[model samples]
Target: MAQITLVAAACVLVLSHSFLPGVKGTTFTIVNKCDYVVWPGILSNAGVPTLPTTGFTLQRGETKTINAPTSWGGRFWGRTHCSQDSAGKFSCLTGDCGSGKLECSGNGAAPPATLAEFTLDGAGGLDFFDVSLVDGYNVPMLVVPNGGTGQNCTYTGCVGDLNDSCPSELKVMNTDGGTGGVACKSACEAFRQPQYCCSGAYGTPDTCKPSSYSEVFKRACPRAYSYAYDDKTSTFTCAKADYTITFCPSPNTSQKSSQGQDTETTAATTSPLDFNSTMVYEGAFEESGASPSILAHVFRSHAIVGIVGITMAVRWIF
Candidate 1:
C-alpha cells in the first residue's frame, strides 16, 4: 500500500504539469467602446504564424481575448461600415482587409486605418508596441499593457476622434455623401506626394519631417504615430505583459460603465472563439489615469507548482 501511494502521488504531479504548461502565451484583450460596431483585422509579421480567425465583428461594448505566442509580432486595426453580401463577401468601407470574407486570414488592413502594432520578445528581451496612424486614421485606438515588470510599460495610443474634424482634403467620406464623416485619411493617402508618404528622396527620417497635415494628427493624438518618422515618442517598450486594445477608449465611457463592464449590444452578434482550439480570452479594464497595477503575470509557474504539491498530498492517501 505504501508503494502504491507513492506511485499515485508521482502520477498526480505529472498530470498537474500537463495541465499547466499550456498557458505561457501572452493574452490580448480587445474591447470596443465605440457607439457603433467594428470589424477588427489582424495581420502577422512576415514569416510569423498568423493568429486564429484574423478578422471578426466586434459590436460596441463587446470584448475579445486572443492568446498569442510570446514571440508574436503583428498589427491590429478596426474596419468600419462593414457588410456582407449574399455570397458572404465581407468588406468594409474604411480599413478593409480586401479578403472578401469575414476572416482576414493573413491579410493586412488597407491604409487609412488606425493601427495597434506589437513586436513581442525582441532585442534584449524587451517588448515593443505602439499605436500607429502612419497608415492613416479610421478610428481612435489605445493599447494598454497590463501586469508587466519593466520600465515604461505604460499605455501607448491615440485618444483623439479625428473624424469629427478631419481636414476636408484628407477626409474619408461615405459614398452616400452623408453629413457625418466616418473616417479620417492621412495626408499620404489623400495625396500621393513622396514627401507625405516618406518615399523617394524623403525616405529617411531626417528628410521626412512632419508636415502641417501630420501635425494636425499629432496635436490631436500626441502619442500616436502621426507620420512615418514619429518614433521618438510613439514607440514604447515593456517586459512580458498582457495587453488591452480599446476602440474609442474615451475615459467618460469607462466612467459610465464602472470599470470594464460588459453591456452587450446587437445588430451584429459575435462570440468568443473556441477555447480549446483558439485559446482566446476576453476581459476588460476601466479607463484609469493611474499607473497600471497587478504585477505582470497570470498563473505563474510557482502557482502551478503549488497546485502540484497540494494534489500530491491528496494522492498520498491512495
Candidate 2:
C-alpha cells in the first residue's frame, strides 16, 4: 500500500513539472544576416495564440528570440525593404503579411517567400520542420535544432539564396524597385495550373509529376518542400529542442559554386540494373542532372508572395 501511494505521488510530480512554466514550450532564435534590413514576420496557426509581436525590424546581423507553446505549429519568414509612411502605415517590399501595419498579428507571409516552417511535439514526440519553396523562394533560410535527443535532429533548410537562379517566368521583383531577384515563385503559384499546384486529378504523388520548373526547385532544395506532393524526402523530424533560424546565413566558402563543371565521357555508358525497381525509379529522378549548388541554393536572399503546399497541409491551417 505504501509503495502504491509513493508511485502515485511521483506520477503527480512528473505531471506538474511537465505543465510548469518555461518548461513546455519551444524557443525560436531568429537571426538576420542579410546586408539590408529584414522585417521578420511570424504567424501562428489558427486557434494557436500568437507571439508577443508578429512583426518587427531585424537589422543587418540582428537576432531575436521568441517563445512558442510545446505543440505550437506555424512558420517564419523575412520581409525585406520595409518602411512606414507618414501616417504610420507599415509595409514591406518582400514577404509582406498584408496587414498594412508593422505587426503581422495573425497573418502568415504571402506566397513566394522562403519559409522556415515548424510543428513542435508532433507524432512520436518528434518535431517536424522544413524549408519550404513550394510557395516560392525568397530569403535563404536555415533551421538548426539546438539541444535535442534524436537521430535526425540535424540542420534542415535552403542554405543558398535561390533568387539568382529563379527562372525568368517565376521571378518576383522587389516592390521597392530593387534590381536583383527578390523571390522565386513556385510553378503552382506562378501558373496556378492543375499540374503545378497538384490539385484536381493531380492529387497523389504518383499523379502529380515533376515539371521542368519543379525539377529545378527539387534539385536545389532536396530537403525542402518543392511541390505540393513533395513529402517523402522533404519532411524532417526531431525531438524537443530550441531552434535557430538564420536568414541568409553567410554563404559558405565552399558553397556549391555554380561555375564548376562535371564532365564525364559517355561514349559507351552502361548502367547496371537494380534488383529493386523502386530504387531504379528513385535513381532516375536523382539522375535528372540537377547538380548541387550552394546546398540547393539560388535567389538573391529576398522574397515576395509564395504558396507552401496547396494539397499537403495537415497541422497548419495556412
Most accurate candidate by lDDT: 1
Instruction: Please give the range of 10 consecutive residues that has the lowest summed lDDT in model 2.
Output: 298-307
lDDT digits (tens) for residues 196-261 of candidate 1: 999999999989999999998787677788999899888988886788898876532212244455
- TM-score of each model, in listed order: 0.73, 0.72
As a whole number from 0 to 100, the lDDT of residue 179 in candidate 1 is 56
Query: Per-residue lDDT tens digits of candidate 2, residues 1-318?
Result: 665555556555654544444454676778776667888888888767666678888987677767665688888888877888999888876788999998897888888788888888989989988888888877867677777778778667775556766789998876565576777888998888999998999988889988999888776666778887778777878886778887765432122335652111110121211224342222111111112231122111111111122122222333
In model 2, where do residues sit more than 4 Å from their true spots? 1-15, 18-22, 252-318
What is the RMSD of candidate 1? 12.1
Model 1 TM-score relative to the real fold = 0.73
Name the candidate that leads on TM-score: 1
| Candidate 1 segments exceeding 4 Å error | 1-23, 176-178, 251-318
